[model samples]
Target: MPSGRRGRATWLGVLGIGLIVALLAVAWLQVRQAALLRQAVEVADDDAVLLVYQAETEYLRLRDEWSRSSDPRRVLDAPALQLRYDIWVSRVGLLHNERIGNALATDTGFAETLQRIDRFIRRADAVFAAPDGPGPTRVALQELEPELMSLGAEIHGLSLRAAHRVGEQIAARNATVQSHNLVGIGLTVSLSALTLAFALLALRQMRQLDRRRAALEDLAEHLRSARRDAEAASEAKSAFLANMSHEIRTPFHGLLGMLSLLRDTGLNQQQVGYLRTAAESADHLLAILNDILDMSQLESGRMVLSPAPVELRALLRDVEALMRPQAHAKALALHIGTDPALPERVLCDATRVKQVLFNLLSNAIKFSDHGAIVLDVQARDNEAMAELVFVVSDQGIGIDEATLGTLFRRFAQGDSSRSRRHGGTGLGLEISRNLARLMGGDITVTSKPGEGSSFSFRMPLRPVQAVPAPRTLPGDAPPPPRPLRVLIAEDHVVNRQYMAALLERLGHDAVFATNGREAVEAMRAAEGKPFDIVLMDLHMPEMDGIAATRAIRALPDAAAATVPIVALTADAFTETRDRCLVAGMNDFLTKPVSPPKLAASLRRFFGSTGGADFAPEPAAPEPAAAGGESPPLVDTAAVALALQAMPRERLAAMVHSFLDQGPQLVQRLRAAVRDAQPLELRVNAHAARGAALNLGLAALAATAETLHEGASHLPAHEIARHVQRFADLLPATRAAAIAAGLPLPAGAAV
Candidate 1:
């Protein structure tokens, strides 16, 4: 039952009991009032009878006195007798009004009694008014006595009936009160029992609630302790990882630095080759460590993705640019294709996406020797989901089913041999998969052992609706041209000669600097005819390419500081490229310096529309006359003719001036190479590359490039070979110039 209904029922029962008590009390009071009325009537009836008897006695006495004396005194006695009669009549009248008429009007006996009283009173009055003086007391007495006696009897009957009815009513009220008291006692006992039961139930509920609350508090305390423990564990793990990374990096940095310093110490061919391999291993180790650190940070949720609108075309171009060199080295064909439906721009984390692409492309290049790598991008609209997908597939040594299963598993490599041959920490695929998932996408692989492998990357790429296409800079937009002043900074004399020869043939006026520092110095020193572009070497002893670039950028003069600087290096790592950019270099051109890469670098700074149209650089000048003798090896006139072929008289003048300075430059290059001073070797090589390039001596410039690259690790004897080669070429080069109607300067060998 509902509590409210129960309470209402209890209140109604109490109200009913109250009403019953009130009614019973009223009944008892009524019975008592009836009893009093009946008693009063009986008393009145008795009083009337007594008064009648007294009047009768008095009347009889008065009558006797009247009969005994008829004198005047007798008349006075009669009047007094009449007064007593009047008193008796008044008493009778009171009896009738008080008892017979008012108290018992409804009762026949009581009415008869009232009538009898009235009759008796009438007789008394008549006697009192009689003139015979109390003549016959017997006459008045006789009439009143009968009437009064009859009234008394009637009054007695009426009083007995009223008293009986009142007594019966009182008995009924008393019985009712007793029954009511019994019922009230029962109700009180029942109420007490109910209150006790309710108290017990309430106490039980309170106890149960207390138990539950205690249990909850205990659970809360345990949970708080567990949470604190988990937090402490997590913090400890982060601290350990940070410490480990720092410790590893410190030693690794020293190792790389020592390796760098080792290059300056002269080493034989075998040692040089071993050192190169070791350096490569060190680099790979560093890469793996970095990748692991990156993965750990990413898993810890410490790294945040930076999304930006990126041009897919430009991104692909960069990817191709990065991977092309690797493919060339491996003798592999790389194919990149995209659907025209692909969006111009996509919303993505450019850095992460680029990283993924680089990893994929690098892996493909690593595994493939002669096969092709195909990068496919498609934009498809499906009814369920509209998105663009990118896939990169390669015709490399494929993975088996078992290997593919664990392809993206952490720290899992496809094969032990593969890991040994092609070193990797195996975190790349795992990280890539995690990154893809974070981007609301995924990565998958399909491969067949001994056939080929295709790795596919699918991501939900949002179309960038409002991104503008990148505009080509004014310098890069124009067609290839020449007759421009080009600066070549190298450290090997032969390589410098080779570059100068190539530049002359390309119809570009070339200036020579032995090293990056000298290149910057030369540019600063020039009063007029400032070099338009600087071709910088990566590894020069005194001031490396990066440092020189920084120095040039910080120069006070605008012309020297703002000149375009391109790096010529053998290190093609992404980190190296980043370093170049950080150093304010305009571009990166890796060695062994090829004609196409060289032309491209030059074209980057010099607009194509209108420049010199020069002849091809002369191949190598004929070797010096037989066995270690005094033969003029180079044809200087031929070199001059090649320069003049560009139809630029100014370029010819530059060539002539360069030849005049050649002997002195050669002497300095020999001394630097003999001393095994990388910095000086770099300076001399750079000068020769420039001068040789200006004179169209392709062979000499190429040799100088070799000396430049190998300077740090190449032994003193090896360095001497490049110096001797450059020295032998000077005579033939001067001869070639003079033969082309460009006279050699005074004291110049011919």
Candidate 2:
């Protein structure tokens, strides 16, 4: 038992023992007192003394009456004489009582006196038996009086003896009561002392408890203060990290951009090799920066996963595409396979999954010189949930058990020798494991010295139905057809120059704005000749990209208000992307934007035929009679092609954006039809048809096609009917696209 409880139990036992002893003392006192009281009651002297004294007094009275009866002077008073005799006999009978007799028995003369009195009374009863029987009653009375008078001395002696014996017994009882009182007082004092000691013990215990409680309160306060200090320190660190990331990446993007531009400068063979080596080093530095950022986000609990329905095979293919080149350079074999039970599509964060696989595969390739690296995927049943497991095995420098224990720890590498040979930030495995755990899974490794290592990553399996493949833009297969007028909003001069050079190389005109204010002013100044697109930088002075985009969206001119604005910032955070999109930007592109990435973003808005230069005067749409079949609700083939160019989420957003604009298109078509302006009607229908075709909304595109084909020759009522039909097809097309496994953006209305 705990010491405190044991001490309490000991105190309780002592108290119980004291209580029992006190109770026993009280009982003994009570018994002694009761015995004294009983002794007093038994030895009462009043009855014995009174009985003997009365007997003597009656003897005197009888003797006097007898003397009178014997004398001639009293006449013959027989009745009076008999009464006195009877009184004397009755008094004598009382003296014979057992209580009085026993009390006086200590005097040996008591019994004899009682017996004589009884004998004399019996003799007197004969005379008194018949009141009228004799005239010689005087003689009878005279005889009884002598005997009664003789017995008086004996009775008087018995009275004195009873008084003496009772006095002795009373004295003895008083002594016993006094002794019991003394013992009871001593017992009471002992019990009171014991009770006081118990009270003192209880008071001491209470004081000790109070001290413990105060100490605990102080400790708790210290813990709370420490926690607050730690939190403040952590916040400061996170702030420093974010600020440094921005400061570093802003220049880093320019460096990478210049490197990209340097490639086109017609260099000799040796210069080209030097350029390639510098670019590789730059890429390696960028990778380290990304690892640091990832680690910081993971530590601060800010890394969020964007899980969606991803095609399993496509994700694996993407990993293979990036890793195969590294493997070929090392002269090592790379094999990737999946179990037949694996689902075709599953719900997961494709980007994070690919990142983890990339890290594992890169490590394998880095360590091994010639042996094969295998990535095998399998499915397993874990109780009620299904699990997907990825195993990466490499014939590399295997780790020992001692090193394996610290393998996944932060900044821990395989060994000191290997760490020196192959330098790294040593955060890739840690970051990968953290991401796996965030997704409700974990990563584990098994290795033996001089043998290969196998690392396994497992996560929950959430299968989803297959979605239609995204349609590919013509830019994926061909170059741009025409140059676009591009607006650049940036604060840094180097970034602005890099963007200008990049756009010029893509055969496009470039306009520069130093900040958001200047960008908005540039849009307003364009007036009749608006720029084809706006490339917004988020962290510019005076006003940021979000505010500038919002301001430009509020423009009175329709062309300026509707121009596509893409965020081009160094901030790669998800919240930044969401803020840009919510502020009405068309798309988001992170820092260090490559030529191919920029080109792809442009192709998303303007197809291969190119910018607004070709949009205003579109070719007339063919009539429905040219094709007998009606258009389907959604074109799965076109959507499949788009998937090759961009992600499904990006395509879904575009579809939703186009649908949200349906009401505006319907209003414009109605106005054109009401005014009977074929030119206006054709322009609106052509724009809608182009947007619908790009997003694979076949039915809406077909309806717009009809309106465009009939705009000139058809009646106003026919154009109005086509416009109404176009309006009716919007809701159905959205539902068809969503049913085809393109999820709507978060928090979007159904």
Candidate 3:
């Protein structure tokens, strides 16, 4: 097409050049011809006729002079007469001038007259010759007189004829000039016409160019529109997926909870096995749902990472424990190895990292029927960054080359036929890869036909100075142990039943509210009843957990306002957790809750009073000295940990400071309860609780936690009783501090 355009342009150039050259050539020729005609007119209009007139007049004057001389009575001076004759003869000779010659050439009579004049001059010149040659005499003068006189008429006639011929020549030259002017005018008009045509063609070509430019702009606009349309569709798809995920998972969580409850119901062995399998299938389906939701979040750029310092070794240990059962179920060996060079704590989103690892390990286990799957961790350094590399290698039915290619692509499975046998949504790997990238890491796989596949996740590892101690395993430090009056606020029947069964097993009295509204009403109606905790389901119909919590806190009766509120929901989003916290809820729990987790929540609120299952091992009773001295109330180890959290002087100040303000805090709590301001009571109680805990005042801290928890729901009289108890303990706590050897401020006393 470009060549064709160039060819067209070349033709236009040739045609334009050719036309201009033709016009220029015509103009140049006309100018040259006109210049020639002008030159001819100038030549034809020369002074020949004027010269002829002068010569003829001189002839007449000579004849008159000679005729006068012919008077015999006059004393004719020969020399003087001869002088006049010679002058006349000179005039006659000038007839031979070029202009005169050309003028007379076309005049037959003018030439003859010029010849007659020349003869007369010749004859008369003999008398006017030099003294040595001749002298003018009377007879000679008389003879020449008649001839000179006759020649006068002839010369006059010749002059008249020359003037007429000059007029005709001037007329002819004017006609020739008119012809050249006409030719020049015609050539100029033709040139103007061609110029107008060329301009019109150029103008038309410019319009076409403008049209093409507009077309290109339109095409660009169309592409932008198409891109925008595609983006909108993608955004819509993301929204739909998020909504659908929430809807499906909410009920799905209830189903899982029901399954947990069903297991407790005594049943036949076959029924138990079927139920377990059904539960596992449901769990798998939920997992697939989660994977789909993750993919949607990632594809829409809605996923966010919250990174914190994580203990790498502990994280691997947790991974091993979780994967061991599945490995054992399949009779496969699972090995996890960590290099000594790895950092104790690295900055990462621990949950997401675990998730990616879990996905990879799960796939490894599922694909491998019997062989071992090994997870190895090590520190790797590149030019730009340091990384923690985790490699999960499996030996079993090896992945084929073709299957490995799409292993990480969304909705892609290795073998179509095996998808049913090993069901999955096929988005796990894709989600894992996206998550890795979000945290400045990547997941890659290498596999060969009939050989093992190795999947590696590498993340940029940032070391942290404050390495948190290894997390205390469950049972090593049991959950908060305590049973208490519990309020279950849930809308789903199955979920409510599950909570009932679980709460009954935990040896706690349980009351029910169908939704947030009923829950609030139940608390209000309790009328100082001892409801230890409120499990507020977030997705209730009448009012959500946040709103209900707010309403409860604002209740006029302080006892009914400051109840311990725990948000329960199926939402696993960070935003939802934040919403729960921001709404004045004391704790948050994701649904499909286990007995241990529920017990933990209860223990967190009721502490030692709740039960031993969740209670921290009681601080050993202070031992008496060797001499049977009084025992110290404070633990030295707990005090040392406190000192590490603050300077010794600050710790002492805080301990003394809390004792000094103890009375005032108690008074405020009482006043808040009397005034029905649960927020104020909760705040004061929370402050006291924190300070008391920090100072190792276990009894005071425990009392404050109760006040903080029950300020709204515990009766005003009961709250006052707790307050009086708190005041009485101050003196005892001071005595214990002195016994523990902690120095008191000056002027302070037990």
lDDT to native, each model: 0.64, 0.75, 0.72
Error of 3 at 696 (Å): 58
Q: Highest lDDT among the candidates is held by which one? A: 2
Model 2 is weakest, by summed lDDT over 10 consecutive residues, at: 611-620
Candidate 3 TM-score over all chains jointly: 0.29
- lDDT for each residue of candidate 1 in 1-750, tens digit (9 for 90 to 100): 899879858866775576566556555655655564454444333343344444355445444543433333343454444434444443334444454344344556655555665666566567555433445354455555545444445544544665554555456666656655555565555556556655765786688798689789989999999999999997887677777887888899999999989988999665776687578557656755765654566677776778888999888866765575566456454656678678878999876676777777777777775556778888766666666666877766788888887888877887768677979877778887777777767778888977788777777768889745688887786444447787888876545655675576667778877777897788788646777888888776677787888788667565576577888765568878756755667678765454545665565455352434444434654655655544333435444454443344544455566665666776677556433357777756755664465455555666676777788887544666666677667666666655666564556444
Give me the runs in candidate 1 sitting further than 4 Å from their true place.
Answer: 1-310, 313-404, 407-534, 539-541, 546-565, 569-599, 602-648, 669-686, 698-729, 741-750
As a TM-score, model 2 comes out at 0.29
Rank by lDDT (best first): 2, 3, 1
Q: Candidates' TM-scores? A: 0.32, 0.29, 0.29
lDDT per residue (tens digit) for residues 1-750 in model 2: 999989979977987787787678767767766765566556465677766676677678877877788776678787566555545554565565677766666677777766777777678667666523664466666666667668667766776777787678778777877876776676677667767866887888798898799799889999999999999997898778777888888888899999999999999765886787688657656755765764667877887889999999888866775676577567565667678788889999987788789889988888886567889999999886899999999878898989898998877888767767877767889988998999999999999877789999999999998766688887687444877899999765445655665576567899999999999999999986879999998766689788898789778665687688999864467777656755667678864454556777787667552432211222324655754878888878666655544568866877787788788788788666644567788766765665566566788877887897799988444566677789788888889999997878988996
lDDT tens string, model 3, 618-648? 3446644676743234546545544433356
Each candidate's clash count: 51, 13, 15
| Alpha-carbon lDDT of model 2 | 0.75
Q: Candidate 2, residue 585: CA error in Å?
A: 47
Task: Tally clashing residue pairs in candidate 3.
Answer: 15
